[model samples]
Target: MLESWRWYGPYDNIALSEVRHTGASGIVTALHEVPYGDVWTRDAIADRRQEIERAGLKWVMVESLPIHERIKRDDGDLSQLFANYRQSMANLAEQGVNAICYNFMPLLDWTRTDLTAPTRYGGTCLRFEATRMAAFEIHMLEREEAAEDYPADVLEGAKAWFEASGEEERNTLLASIMSGLPGAFDRYDIAGLRKALALYDGIGREQLRVHYKRFLEEVVPAAEDLGVRLCVHPDDPPRDILGLPRIVSNADDIAWIMGAVDSRANGLTLCSGSLGANPANDVPAIARQFGDRIHFAHLRNVAKDADGSFEEAEHLDGDTDMVDLVRALLEEEARRKQEGRADSNIVFRPDHGHEMLMDAERQNPPGYPLIGRMKGLAELRGVIRALA
Candidate 1:
């Protein structure tokens, strides 16, 4: 499953020569002008891998290098942000880039109230509407106990959807849950998300899983001495909003984060639309029980709703089973090529799509447009060519 495509660099407006005509060779990106705890040097990851090898493709996964809110709230000067995230994983393993994708969700990163919702094939997806995110946390980021996190008929249907909405639909649902979309590094406005939800006042969920196990005991041994891998990334509406603390949602929080870092460069980026927007997440049995620590993949599909809403559906039509999650990721890439594993080709992408045809007149980046992810990478390349 090495077909890839998340660009967002070189000022992405869908160009890397139009993502080399969407049959994707590989290019999930990052660098994003290096900011959050800085230092991604090795000449800026070889100048974005020579601009995705001058568009012939293949940058092969970074998708993120972010994790900073003082290393997700272990508070300021976290040893200089864990030594600039272990020198950005030794400057992305000095250039041959090894899968990285990251996320430890704190003050929102991967959320939506509706970036145009509609889809009975008239196309336009991205939703997530638990009472419109509890009417943007009880009347737009007011957030203090936020009506005891909903359920008096979801806080009276979020107070009649915030009094039948007005003020430009509550400022377009507070700029669709505080702006920043494509690979979202940061963005906030209702007084910077109410001072980032008062720095997670009394941080819950076992203190954010002990600050993500002290950020994987200081960046998983510098991503296992630079052979990289590091995946993480879940919790996009997996649970608990505004009150924070969503420690990598489910599959027993990824077996308590692969038993809190017993490495093989500690992995998992299996985002079947963020753990299938939680319908008791069983996306192909968590892709065959964590398919050998799954280093990268985000194949999309959502359609959930037993009250905790969801949307984005057409990567083989939601409630994920995209052909049994692509035949359990092609039987975990034939068990990592029968155990000879040198990361036996993983890279997936086609994560969020459905803004549809001419990407509904492109404004792009909101579940990333480009003809709805080239029709979800041509329906995941015809289900990985009829299941390989």
Candidate 2:
């Protein structure tokens, strides 16, 4: 894996100089300033590339050129939207950026109820509490029929939370879940969200899968033409939250996705933290099977609860078998080398990290504290070096 760190463009608190110090050679980023549905002009791509290169880092992956909600729903000016996407691909390729990571999650981009929850250590970590989430989904956003989706325990828990939560706490939780986290995507308003949902109305899981297939069918050819890999990130928590359908969760979903485009340009992001939130997903096995097609990787772990709630775990201590997982990925890399493939490097990032040490004082984004991820990257680097 070409070790990388996600940089949130020029506005990020963790600067490129800091990223260079993280011992990562590659930078995974996007033109977040370029608004939704707008084309990432070749000039913009080149400028970002130049900035990273000047700092002695390569722009290995376009963390995303976000596909607009309109495109996801197949609503409003799709011809123009897709044209923008294709143009963005060409622009990225022109600047030698290869891997492109995007997600098909609707309404929200990777929701988490708590960003600063206390961890087992004397620091803070990100967590997703199911009951608190249900409270927001049912009582706050009031997604129609949301209560029916939860069990009795979850529903009651949510109700209790909602009743106890102050107005400010409730509002913050809603914003966190609705707004795209700093590097992920932008936030959405309830009215705007309903409009996005209207596009997927009456569209069930199978239909959404078909829609994704149709999307890849269109996007992958362009990506292949441009020598770029379009890697889709899996649904966080690996389940349908907020009544939205999630197509990429498990192995079957991956198989279906790869079968759709049937090209190396179409690939997976393989986020361990996201997939490992589900106890049933065999993370190492999935990596081994899809390793050839994985262009981007997010390595983090989660300690899952019996009730389906979870907290982000330290990279090496979580339920995910980090050692086995790394060995498997290296094996896959070895296979790729044996085949003499000419692809861009596989990009990996420490997906989320605990807020530890001085980082505990810095008001960083949830799961993105610099010190914690630096520790994770250093640990993984040592493991990789020893194995090599």
Candidate 3:
């Protein structure tokens, strides 16, 4: 596996010079400035590549070229959107960046009810409390039949939380879930949320799967033609939170996705933190099973609670056996080498580190604190070096 770091473009607090100090040769990033549905011009991609190269880092993977919501929902008549997306892929591959990491998650991207959950070490880690999230969905967002989505204990817990929360707290919860974390994607207020959710009103899991497969059928061919690997990231938390459909969550989902398009270009990101949030997902086993198709990896762990709560754990400390997972990925790389495959080394980043030490004062995006991720990268590096 090749070590990499995710750098939010020019305005990111951790500069390219600092990324070098993290001991990662590869940088995973995207042109976040380019608005939704807009083409990432070849010139823009080149300029970004030049910047990373100038700092002695290679832009290994486009962390995402975000899919438009209109494209995801398939409101019919998507010729232009598909054309633009294909153009973006062509532009990226032409710029010598072939690996693209993206997700088909609707509405929100990795929702968390609490941004600053306290850790035992006096640092903060990202967390999702089931009851608090339920409260937001039931009492705050007020989605019709949202209460039916939760069990009796969760609904009762949500009631208690909702009644006790002040207006400010309620508003914070709304922003965290709806805003798509500011730098990630578009922001949605209550009206915007309702409008977006309404788009998927009649679309359940099956219909959503239809739209997803349709998307792959169109885009995967373009990706293959462009010599680009499009890796679909697993659904964060591996479940539907806001009543949206889930297509890529478990091993079965991965098998279906791989078979859907059935091309080497159609790959998986293999985000451990996201997939490991669900207890049933055996992280190491999945890595071994789908080893060849995994083009990218997000290596982080989480401590799970019985009530669907998950707190970000240190790189090797969570429920998933980080060592065994790394071993599996290494074994795949070794196999690829023996087979003389071109994509032998998978690109991986230390994902979603806790806000530790001076990170509290740094105020980088939640789960993206420099010191925390530096620590995570170092720990993961130690694992790789020892195993390899």
Candidate 4:
């Protein structure tokens, strides 16, 4: 595996020089300044690549070039959006960046209720509480028929949670759910978010699957032509939220999407944290099964509870078996090498690290504090070296 780190470009609290010191040879990033549905010009790609190269890091993967809402909803002029997407793929390929990671979750990207949940080691980690999310949906955003989405007991739990939360807690929960995260281009207020949810009002899992297949149909060929691998990231939290369907969650979902395009160019990002959030998803098994199709990897662990709550845990100390997972990745790499594939060495980054050390003092993005990720990378590096 080629160790990599995600950089949010020039404005990131952590600089390129800081990333280089982590001993990661590659940088996984995107042209975040470019808006969704807009073409990423070759000039911009070149400039970004130049910047990373100057820091002695190679730009190995585009973390995302977001698929526009217009395209996801099949609303508006999709042809123009598809054209822009194709152009971005071409631009990335032209700059020798092949692996592109993206997600198709509607309304919100990856979400967490608490960005400062306390860890055993006095660090802070991102956390998701199902009851809190339900509270936000039913009592906060007040989405139509939101009560039907949760179990009877869970609904009562959510109601209790909502009633207990004061003004500050409510505001914080609202911001965490509606406001965008680092690299997320969209943000919405309460009314705006409600309006956004209304658009997907009737769209369920089947319809969302259709839209995803249509997305693959439009972009896979272009990706193949440009020699770029389009890796679709799993739905964060790996379940339905805010009354929206989450199409890409489990192994079957991955199989369905991979079968839609049936090309090497159409692939998976294989995010362990997202997939592992649902205990049903066997992280190592998924890694072994889809090893060939995995284009990029986000390796982090989470400690999941029976009540559908989870917190990001130390890299090697959660539900995911880091040893077996890394071993599986190595086996996949060996297979690719034997098959003479050009992208044999997978580019993986330590996904979400706890907020600890000096990182806790800085105004770093949640899950993206510099010292925390460095600790994760160091641990991962040790595992890879030991296994190799």
Candidate 5:
């Protein structure tokens, strides 16, 4: 597992110098300034790669080259959108970026109702409070047929939570919920969001899954030819949010996806925090089963609650068995080495860190506080060293 940090391009307050001091030698980044449905031109890709090289960090993976809403909905001049996608991959390949990490979750990328929940550790951490989320769906956003998804008790809890929350708290919650993950979908306004939702009104979970397969069918062959591995990231929180479908949730979904494309280039990003949000998902088992096709990894853990809510825990503190997971990767890496695969680079980053210490004052992105991620990288580094 190559130790890496996710950088949100040049504008991020966390500089490359800061990243270097944190003991990470690789970077997981993207052309974030580039808009969706456009090509990341060859010159632009080369410039970014050169910038990373100058910082003494290898550009290991692209966090994403975002798939546009039009592509997801199978609409809006897809021929041109797909052509741009192919051209982007070609650009990345030329720049030596082999693994591209992306997701197919419709509309929002990940949702969490609370930005700063009191952790048992006496510091603030990111959380997914169910009640606050319902307040948005049932009373605020008010999507059609939203109530059918929750139980009676859950609905009541949401009401109570909404009634108790102040305007500031509610605003904080909404901001946190809509803050898209790095390189994932953008936040949507009520009208803009509704328009995006309308495109998928008749499309069920199965149809969305098929649409994703079609995307890979069109995209992966080019990826294979260019030696670029297209790594589909799992749905964050691993469930449906805001009446939208999450296709890459569990092992079966991933298996179905791989079966759909049946190509080495179409692979999984293997995010522990995302999959661990669902207690039913056995992360270690999935690692073993699909280890061969796992081109990228986002290693972090989550503490899941019984009512289908969760919070970001320390890298090793969550429900996922870090020991078992790391060991499995070690075994897989050894096998790949024995098989003589040239590009055996498994780009792993410490996903979703706690906001703590000096980072308390810094405007670090949610779940990406510097100190917490530094600690996580050190812990993961130790594990990798011991395995080696």
Candidate 6:
């Protein structure tokens, strides 16, 4: 396995010099400055690669190339957008970066309820609570459809929580729940969120899956031609919220997805934290089952309660058996080697670490603090070394 770290680029606050000392030689990043539907020009890709190389690190995988909403919804001038997407892939491959990661979560990405839930260890971790999220939809966003999506008991609890939470608390919840991943929702507000959600009013699970399948069909050939691995990241909570459908959540979902396009280039990111967020998903089992299809991985763990709530836990101490999961991935690597596969070794990064140590003071893009991730990578490194 090739150890990697995810960097949000120049403004990530943690310097490249600091990144070099973290024991990760490769970086997982994207040209987030580029607009979603526009083509990532070869010059832009080359420039990004140059920046990483100058830092004494290789640009390994694109955490997201970001599939445009038009492509996902099957609307607008999609032919051009799809062409742009392929061009972006070609541009990256031209620059020697092969692996690309993306998520199919419509409109919003990786929604969490709490950005700073205090831990007993004195550090803070990103948290997701069902009631708080329900409250966000029912009260804050004021979506008429969301009321039907959640259960009666859940609705009651969410309503009560909404009534009890103060103005500041409500505002915090609004920001956290609506703040789509790193670059997607920086300036987003409630009106913006509702507008995005309205676009997918009638699109259900099956239709969304159809869109995803078409995406694979159109994009996989380009990836295969370029010797690139295009991996789909799992939904963060791995469940439906705000009436949005999730097609890539569990083992069956993965099976369906991998079945859509049969090629090594069409692959999975295999995020343990995302997969483990759903109690039904056995993380190690998924790794073992889809090991051949996994091109890149995000290694992290989560502590899940009975009520479908979870928070980030130390890499090694969570519902997921980290050592066993790593062992499974390593075994897969050995299998690839035995088969004489060229794209055998996988690049993996420690994801969503607790905001601990010196990181507690600085402002980080929730769950991506410097010290926390370094600690996680160090712990993961120890496991890999011991197993090897």
Lowest lDDT 10-residue stretch of candidate 5: 181-190
Candidate 4 Cα misplacement greater than 4 A, ranges: 179-185
Give TM per candidate.
Answer: 0.33, 0.95, 0.97, 0.97, 0.96, 0.97
lDDT tens string, model 1, 243-312?
8878788899898899887887899998898888888888889879888898888898888877778888
RMSD of each: 18.6, 1.9, 1.2, 1.3, 1.6, 1.4
Lowest-lDDT window of 10 residues in candidate 3?
176-185
Q: Write the per-residue lDDT of candidate 5 for residues 1-388, one digit (tens) a residue.
A: 6889999886567989889998889999899888888999989999988988999999999988889887788875688888899999998998788789989988777788777788776667888877677777887677868788777777899888878879887667767877863343466665676776787888789888878877998899999999988989999878888888888999999999999989889899999999999989999999999999998889998898877779988888899998889988888888999999875657799987887778778787778888888988888888888877
lDDT of 6 by residue, 1-388 (tens): 9999998885588887888999899999888888887998999889989989998999999988999887778886678888999999998999999889999998777988998899878999999987888898888889887877777877888999999999999888887876664464355578877777789988999999999998899999999999989999999889987788999999999999998998988899999999999988999999999999999999999999776779999999999999999999999999999999987788899998998888967786778999999999999999999998
How many Å off is the CA of 59 in candidate 2? 0.7
Clashing pairs in 1: none
Off by over 4 Å in 5: 181-186
Candidate 2: how many backbone clashes?
1
Model 6 misplacement above 4 A: 151-153, 181-186
Per-residue C-alpha lDDT of model 2 across residues 1-388, encoded as one tens digit per residue: 7899988886578888988888899888899888877898988889999999999998888877777776667665577888888988888888898779999876566878888789876888888888998898788777887887778999899999999989899878877676454334555666666665566788779877776777887789998888888899999878987787888899999999999889988899989998998889999999998998998889998999877899988898999998888888888888878888875346689888988889966566667889999988988888778877
- The candidate, 1 or 4, that scores higher on TM-score is 4
Task: Output the TM-score of candidate 4.
Answer: 0.97
Q: List the residue pairs that clash in candidate 6.
A: none
> What pairs collide in candidate 3?
none
lDDT of 3 by residue, 1-388 (tens): 8999999886578889988989899999999888877898999999999999999999999988888888778887998888899999999999899999999888677888888888898888888889998998888788878887778998899999999989999888887675454245567777778877888888888888888898899899999888899999999878887889888899999999999989989999989999999999999999999998999999999999988889899999999999999999999999999999999998999998989778888667778999999999999999999998
Residue 327 alpha-carbon offset, candidate 5, angstroms: 0.6
* Candidate 3 overall lDDT versus native: 0.89
Each model's C-alpha lDDT?
0.82, 0.83, 0.89, 0.88, 0.85, 0.89
